[model samples]
Target: MGLGRGLAIGTLAVGLLVTSETPALAGNGPAYKDSWRPVKVRVADLLGRMSLDDKLGQMMQAERLGVKSPADVTTGRLGSLLSGGSSQPTPNTPVTWADMYDGFQKAALATPLGIPLVYGVDAVHGHNGVYGATVFPHNIGLGASRDPRLVQKIGRATAEEVSGTGIDWDFAPCLCVARNDRWGRTYESFGEVPQLATEMSTVITGLQGTRLDQPGSVMATAKHYVGDGGTTGGVNEGNTEISEQELRAVHLPPFKAAVDRGVGSVMISYSSWNGVKMHAGSYLINDVLKKELGFKGIVVSDYNGVDKIDGKTGFTPEEVEASINAGIDMVMVPYNWQTFIDTLRTLVQQGRVPLSRIDDANRRILTKKFELGLFEHPLTDRRFLKTIGSKDHRDLALQAVRESQVLLKNDHHVLPLLKHGKIFVAGKNADDMGNQSGGWTVGWQGTSGPVIPGTTILQGIRSSSSKVTYAKDGTGIDQSYDVAVAVVGETPYAETKGDRPQGMGLDDTDLATLQKLKDSGVPTVVVLVSGRPLDIAAQVGDWAGLVESWLPGSEGAGVADVLFGDYNPTGKLPVTWMRSAGQQPINVGDGRPALFPFGYGLHYSRHW
Candidate 1:
């Protein structure tokens, strides 16, 4: 009989398998079912019993929306499922997510082997897919704080939130050392230097906790492995055409750090090195990452990452064979998962892809499942559900927001606005939570206007001072107001859509608003809410003060904290600030003058 038919017969014979609450067997069951056995031993025992179909199913990961029904997971024997950035259940509440996870997990346990499914999500910056979850500053903002310990705490908090929703994997702490600000995903990167990204990898520890099986601990993924940030022209998924020496020096340190930290997974990048797609580059994926770096954990492909191996829209049999052979343990097929599974199985049977590779992938994947204690605790631990968006997490986010504020230009102590003054707040980002949070907040590219619950900068300013006026476009402003604060910058954007190919300056609306504030003759403070540095040299001379509040998610009060002296501005530039868009890809020690040098920041006591 075929593997598929055999799987159906085996599942029927097994009947309704025991739930995670009960051990599948008594003292006499297989060693793999025993929690007391070492993870390696259990993985080996389980691998011996799994059919070829089971192993194939374990290699496929489909998107949650693409699953035709719960039976698809059981029949296909899927090992994992993920919610795309915009994918969410109705109402998008914490409880709803928990319910959804439990529903999917129940189907996985019904398989013949009863292996629990490991659900994954892009909890990039705090369980960002769920509504009401605490949205912390993006990686760029944390990079400015230069506090690894703080980043670790944020990671722990993020893990708790993710665990509450029953997600075992987080595709985060994007270890990319963004070489250019024009990259749309620059905000996702820690900084431009390998050292900074290396230091921030502490988040892997926080996410995985002391152990993978520990309560509230989730598996962490060091993502977009290799030279994603060094792509020429700052193009998303573009080619990185540097030498092997330069690649090792600039792009390889963070992955090494992640491997050293025992990160549960390393995601392959969509970008290529020397015109070779990372998804299919065996030299880098197997030789460099798996062998040289000694990364024992699973190597997962990015979203439909394997499909792009052939540089086409859809995946080919060759693409599948190349990616799997390149040391990718699991493929995130998303939509066309069935096709992937069928093609992979055919390739293996045809001797085009060896069974040794399949077993190797299964072993790596099962090791994590065993380590995570999935066999014993397959359901959502409701204990963490209460922790989502809890006051404690929000407080932590507030502190992160405070530390991420980089004071660029504070002329004559214009900041720490006196306790008694009428403050006029204007600009598109001033009163918008979505803008403050930036991309990856409840949605993919993230939308504007209260997409999630969070205090806006204007609200923060109002609460800080009794006298405060707000206008979106800087209307009705005069010298009568002691200060005019314009919180303006790029709105929400993610990945390719966010790439600024040409001009990277303030928009006409922002300019008009700043002009209004400038006309008032009142000292104006320009608080830029952006994912990366903007081209503001021409206008920097016009503003009395400038602050780079790089997407301070959910905690605008922290921005107010710095503006009112409750907290001092200490954040430094994580990436070089270019004087003009013409100076793209500028970096420290690159022999190019910057509008603001890397590591530049001013305190309230210091004046320029």
Candidate 2:
């Protein structure tokens, strides 16, 4: 029977209340319900009892909107639910998230087999889906820190926040080894170097923790499996036209590192390798990733990734069959999930997809579920909910911001402005939290406004100085001010929308701000808040000091830490700073002239 509708799931920030109607004792259920047995034995026992419908459901991952009601999870025997980039529950609080998770999880447990659904979210830089969660620096900012241990700590903190809301999996640590900064997702990559991405795989350990069953630990996913960063023209989901050797050399190392750390899942990229869709690349997905790399974890598809197999508007039977056979264990059918379930079931029944393949997918998925201890404990661990935006997490985030501030130019040491002097702060980004946090923030292409809690650069400056003023357009500035700080550059963006199809110069607003500061005769310090380096060579010469702040999420105080010499500037560029926008895909060893080379950074005490 279908469950009741409008089940008044309230905010769980206070605490969760498991209804008295939950199922009977574990003694009544099969041996698979026993938590003490080895995961494989339990998996096998559970597999024997599951029907074809159950197995098909285990292979499908539906988005939150796709499920009509909580009962749909039980009736359909669905295995997973994901909240897409912008998808959040009503009230959008941590409490709401826990309630929503428990609601869906309760439905899954009502089935005959009572297999728990593994919920996933894109907690790339924290529990990014929830409001008031600690927003750490994006990967580019972390990469500049060159501290894998710190990255791992951030991962652990993120996992705790995610687990508090009952999410079991995170699609994170995008080990794409971004070869071109022009790609909009470059900020998501650790750096351009393979070793950098490889080293940062410590985050995998941090997310999964010492053991999968550990409290507050969530399964980690090393995503966009291979060659996504090497795409020509730095296009999102575009083809990587490189040879297999080049692909192996540049892109495969990070995935290897992730595998070594026992990451629970690997997401296949939407981009093609050598003009062949990764979704249908059987040799790569099955032969290489599964067999060669020995990635025993479930291989998940990107959002609607299988639909692009035939390069069509909708998926065909051929595409579904090919993708499954090619080794995609879980299809992220964000919508139209029932069609996927039916198509796969038809293929398996028709023998186009083998029973062995179906068993393999179920086995891999169930193993993770068992390893995650979902059956034994299927509710939110609310102890960590309070830790979402706790002061400790924000302090760590502040440290990350401090280490990510790359000093690009400091002509004659005009920085570290005296606390007693008159200072003027101006720019569209100076007092904006949304702009500092960049993309994958509260919303998907993150808008610039007071969207979340955090100190603005201007606020940081004011707190650090006795005399300071802010002007969004550099109004009321004179030589009377000891220094003019112009916090300007690119605003918030993500994915293809962030790609620079036009020239990469600063906007007119920023240019005007800089011009006013430059003409004021006060020593000018330009703090650029951007995801990637831009064309600033012409105007950079006019500034007395320049800092590449990247996207210092949630901690403008860290930027102030460097500006006041409380923390020395140590962040190096993670991507090459191009001389101009025309030099689109410039890199360190590419024989092109860069305004600042990769790994270039300076300190107040260092000789330029």
Candidate 3:
């Protein structure tokens, strides 16, 4: 019998004979149901059995909040679901996340074909969407460490935490080579050089494990496909006006590295390449990425990415047709996914979209599901639940924090503060976990105050020494203190809201806070907690020491370790520090004078 006919008979038999603990099918079932078959062979078998609705459903991904009910997953046969950065279940614990994931997976399995649903999340920076999960230092910090091995370890730890929550896919290891400090998402980039981003792609291996089906392994995504960080004026989602050579040189290497590492998915950029929307750029998506780069993985649209194809608010039939034909395998239509399903169906029936394209998309997506072992193990693996925010992961994060600190200035050997001295700490970031963690934390844009469990920088300092005093605005700090530390810089922000088109200096609050400490004349040290470099040259002359703590997540003790000489400062600048906002796009070879050059850093021994 044909695979479709066999699948029908097998489904009936599975319903009658298969128990919760048994295999999905018995001895004489369809080949797709077998766990020992090759992934491609199984995908082909499953594809042959799927109806047009099944194929269409596999191409659609909806937001968890917009899913309405489990009936939506069953009736719509939705293949995937995602939690936007802020979306989470009540209590937002790891167990709750696994419960939510299993609920969705159960609904997906209830469908006639019983195809497993693959849930995705932007677990960028350590399964960041869930509370109490280990939050590693953002990519910029990792880049500064120049340690690919460490990044790979972080990826493994992150996969364990995410797998514990029953999430099998991670949209992370952003390969964008950030060319400008003004870009809000600059911190997401490993560094300005393509080499750095390429080196950091080891995180992909860590996330995916040696094999896709390995325990604690999760699918990795190389994202914002090309040239998101090289936009003019560092505008978020703006056009990248560079030539093909420059694009390949500066922006494409990391993705090439990701593909080399066997990445499971590539997310198309929201930004354009020389006025051409990446979503609708058939030549680049189809010819270059798929054909030239040999990326056999799924090409997923960014969040609502297809809607902006025609520069319009919502997606259209033409946009859908163009995007799919342009090599997009999955469309992340978060809310109006039903409309997407219906529109694509109509387009296919009208001969606007070819059935071959649908089959191709399903083939790529199903291959991954098979490789993930979702057919046999479709529910949450409760074994990994204990790994979330575990002490071991926190220790790793602390080491990352210790290594990512870049000491930009140490005038007259002021750093490595004496352990028993009277030390005064003041600034907005000193005691704030939310501010130190930056964006993509428990919430979408991230919020201030103890949003999750982690040591504040102030707490780290107090734990290290008994003579630490803190004031939010530099109050009560006087000459009597042996040293004054001002932790200050940008607060939490992500993507569009993060771009700094104009001034990129310390705000009045931070400047005022520093001035108070500087005025006291007790050898003031400035510890900057920020995502990207701030324009601090104007006031550098007044500070005794300066340290760049690039949004060290959940481990304030690491920052304290460097401050108190427990760990020597070793992190180098990933991006060049601008002397002024006018030198916005300064890079390593650009030859423009920098306040602190790229790769510039100081050590206590060297400075002393």
Candidate 4:
């Protein structure tokens, strides 16, 4: 079963799915502080006049705005606010989002200089905050394309969506060269290949736009500073055990690519390299990334990454200051800002952290805002709310969904599903956008119920197919069906909650579900949803047709389009599908076991 009339069917499928309405999750909520409109010079001079409390406030970024009202920008000295995906603006809507943002800017300006507050969000894939930003292909999909221009285009698109909604900084262009397929953040990466990461660095060109130092352009953030993708046992947030030389060879290339292209921000990772946390290690963050790489941009910590350093070295704030003296500029203190302020003040008062250090950090932040042209064009056209989930952006997602489907198994021409075939769809994942998008969708560890409105795989398939039956993990087997597709894979999970250092893979229950369908003597098709490839060896044989749909974005209906013979599968594995946890740290490109070489995927063929 090869792709038949793909272009013809794709055109039809897109026309149908294009009509679906998905709203942005953010709302305006109440008034926020820091909505100041000061000139750049005035903002800078204002920073100079601020006391230690006020200056420290400028460095902290929280999940929400810290102030209770508009009076707090200069009064309370709050610096920045961010939405951690799940943290929607109250009364969430596109207008409220703009209003909330303007509120923050209002406060920052209330200060003498009236500087605008730079709002940050994980708009990595799209205006992920606002419901309808064009959710492009994940970095992994872009990796498979090997098209730097496409990556840059995505960067531009992402910037336009995010900026149009009032966000000034985008924490994006995930520079991690995903060495391990088991890592949950795999989809967030360019690929396991260094060259792919190198190519994706072009995203900076899009995020920051053609000019590096310009307002209106969202500042490009190169993330996880060092070897975060090479975590031990493919764990989410764990140690990366590699020599610095090895690190420089494999993981450092992408970040360097961003640095070369002028990324405005670098976010520190939670993981450590060679027993030192990337955030805490003076040698890597300071001497290496800051000095050697010539990354003049501001370096910010991953959310609450400062806490880990104290946990690791039993170091107090003074030690924290030493890390700052080492290279780090701003801290993403998600909570507990008072401690950061008190500690920094104590450090400066004791001469442990110099005024020069504070000035340097503040200068970098201001310089980036200047370079990003944030001061000149601090406000985005809230009017852009009209275009939030526009037809064009959703079409881009459909294009990505069309491109990102990987043909993993097609035995005896069993796939490129026939619309007339009596197919039975079984699995909890079949209809859920939460499962398809995996981590970092509307919420951090996505769930199956009440996903921000979008067409699901089940909905798409039913719309296209003449006959279909659906069931969750365990349900009545559709005995009369000619084929059964068990759309299933890993659920939305992250960090230690989703972490499994030992024997990582899918659960036996999910495998048994496939076995049940296979035992029924039906040709089974398995459509998998996962952040990273799991130990599917036990389950692959149970299905005649297998597809590795690595967290296809809001356009998962495109997966159905390709699967149902509406489109051909063009996606290849961004990271190798490890046979088991033991074979991990798996990459299709390098140091991989013989189980499956890197770049092992089948393109759709007409042959049965």
Candidate 1 residue spans exceeding 4 A from truth:
1-26, 606-608
- Choose the strongest candidate by TM-score: 3
Model 3: ten consecutive residues of lowest lDDT: 11-20
How well is each residue in 1-608 modelled by candidate 4, as lDDT tens digits? Answer: 11223222322423423222312111232111112222233234444445777677777776564445556555646667677867777666667788777777766777754556778888767776565556665677667656677667677777767766688888887888888666767778878877778877888898887775443367889988788888887676678998878899889888888889988889988887877777778888777887889988889888877777756533378557856776778877766655677788889899988887887787777666656555556666565566566776677777777777778888988888888888888877788777776666666665665465566788888888978888776366756888888887777765556665666666776777877787788888888776666677766776788887777767767888988777777776667767777776666545657445556677777743
For candidate 1, write residues 263-307 as lDDT tens digits. 999999999999999999999989998898998888999999998
Provide the lDDT at 185 for model 3.
95
lDDT of 3 by residue, 62-157 (tens): 999988997899999999999999999999999999999999999999998899999999988898999999999999999999889999999999
Question: Candidate 1 or 4, higher lDDT?
Answer: 1
Candidate 2: worst-modelled 10 consecutive residues by lDDT: 2-11
Worst 10-residue lDDT window, candidate 1: 1-10
lDDT of each: 0.90, 0.88, 0.91, 0.71
lDDT by residue (tens digit), candidate 2, 1-608: 11111011111211334355422212333547756445665677678777999999999899998899998899889999999988889898999999999999999999988999999999888888788998988999888999999999999999999988889999998998887777899889999989899999999999999999899899999989889988998899999999989999899999989998999999999999998999999999899899998999999999999999878888889999999999999999988989899998899889999999998999999999999999889999999888899999999999989999999888878877788888899999999989998888888888898878888888888899979988899999988898988999888898889877678889999998888888889899999998888899889889999999988888889999899888899998888899998887887788898999999999889432
Ranking the candidates on TM-score from highest down gives: 3, 1, 2, 4
Name the runs in model 4 displaced over 4 angstroms: 1-54, 212-216, 312-315, 473-479, 588-594
* Candidate 3: residue 481 Cα off by (Å): 1.0
Could you tell which candidate, 2 or 4, scores higher by lDDT? Answer: 2
TM-score of each: 0.95, 0.94, 0.96, 0.87
- Best lDDT among the predictions, by candidate number: 3
